[model samples]
Target: MTYCVGMVLEKGLVLMSDTRTNSGVDNISVFRKMFTWQVPGERIITLMTAGNLATTQAVISQLEERTKEPDERDNILLKSPTMFQVATEIGRLMRGIISERQDANGVKGRGRFTASIIVAGQIKGMEPRLFMVYPEGNFIEASLDTPFFQIGETKYGRPIILRGYDRQMSLEDAAKLLMVSFDSTLKANLSVGLPLDLQVIERDTYEAGHQHRIGHDDSYFAAISDGWGDALKNAFHSLPDYSFYRPDD
Candidate 1:
């Protein structure tokens, strides 16, 4: 499992994903779940995936193949004229893979091969957009009413984002908000461990804005982990003490 989030802000977009994957308590490995594509000054597209590793890798590989194949100018991501079209194409492709897996297996209940994706980026003339694509190939875009999306083991972290996210906030502030959410998720879930990927795409630039990989030893993240814990404890203690009869009294 993983935790991936993408936020749409007045300034642009912010996305982050954790790198841990596990089959059981003892079987664990690290694999990047964030991938990005940029066509210089034309577009910058980023994808963060969560769920079955094989399905996500296959979807990514097919998209990459379309880019590298000479005869295929049909790379939907590189060639799409609008960000909406890009999201649609990705949904189609993702749905196609899951359907193919289900059909091939002949026995399908919940369908073991499942994955969800968060897509974010912009084309030169278009505003930045963010989307969450579910295993069924359907998606919902971030809107003014809901300015962000999350996938994979998302419950533990969602409350913080819901409380703190603001469309008018700066991209830097957005990153900070997500870090808090991610840190909260990380602390509660052993399945979602560290080493995170973060990317920012400023509107209209059609270029990568800020990109970095964070590991457990990172000083800033360490500070956040410690600080959040302390803050929560302080907040809890500061609340009114329950008025109960005491044995001493």
Candidate 2:
């Protein structure tokens, strides 16, 4: 299991993903779930993945290979003229892999080769965009009505983003908001452990502006975790006390 989020903002895009994967309580390990490809001033695409590790890794490796060997181009990430095309090609690759695996294994392999992906980036002369691609190879884009996407262990942290996300917030603030959300999830689920990879793509820059890893010992993340816990306690206490025995009763 993992936790990954991609947010769209007026300023640009923010992406974060945890690095933990486990077969069980005793077999936990860390593997990077975020991958970025860029053409500097032309385009920058970031993808965060969750689900079957092998499925995700194979998809990523194929995409990377296309970059190195342009002659094998069916649909290269850099060759795509728009972000939509980039996502379509990725979906095609992922779907093909899952389908091939399932077909080879027959009925028992139905859900075994599943995965999900969040794609976020900007192409020259266009507004930054964000997408959540499903295991079925279909995807939905982020817009004013839906300005963010999260894949993997999402339920635990979704409320925080729902309450705090602002379309006009700075990239810095968006990162902070996601940190709190991830902290909440981290506390609730042992499967989604740190360190987390965070990246910010500022609109029109066509490149990642900020990239970081927040480890277990990172002071800033520690502070945010502690502070959020304390703040929640204070907020809960601040609400008016409920009275079972009221005068009207």
TM-score winner among the candidates?
A: 2
In Å, residue 51's CA in model 2 sits off its true spot by 0.6
lDDT of 2 by residue, 121-174 (tens): 999998898988887899999989999999999999999899999999989999
Per-model TM values vs. the true structure: 0.91, 0.94
Model 1, span 64-152: residue lDDT tens: 66446577645668888887887787788888888888889884766788888899999887788898888887888989998888898
| Residue 196, candidate 1: alpha-carbon lDDT | 93
Considering every candidate listed, which one attains the maximal lDDT? 2
The pairs that clash in candidate 1 are none
Predictions in order: lDDT: 0.88, 0.91
| Angstrom error at residue 162, model 2 | 0.7
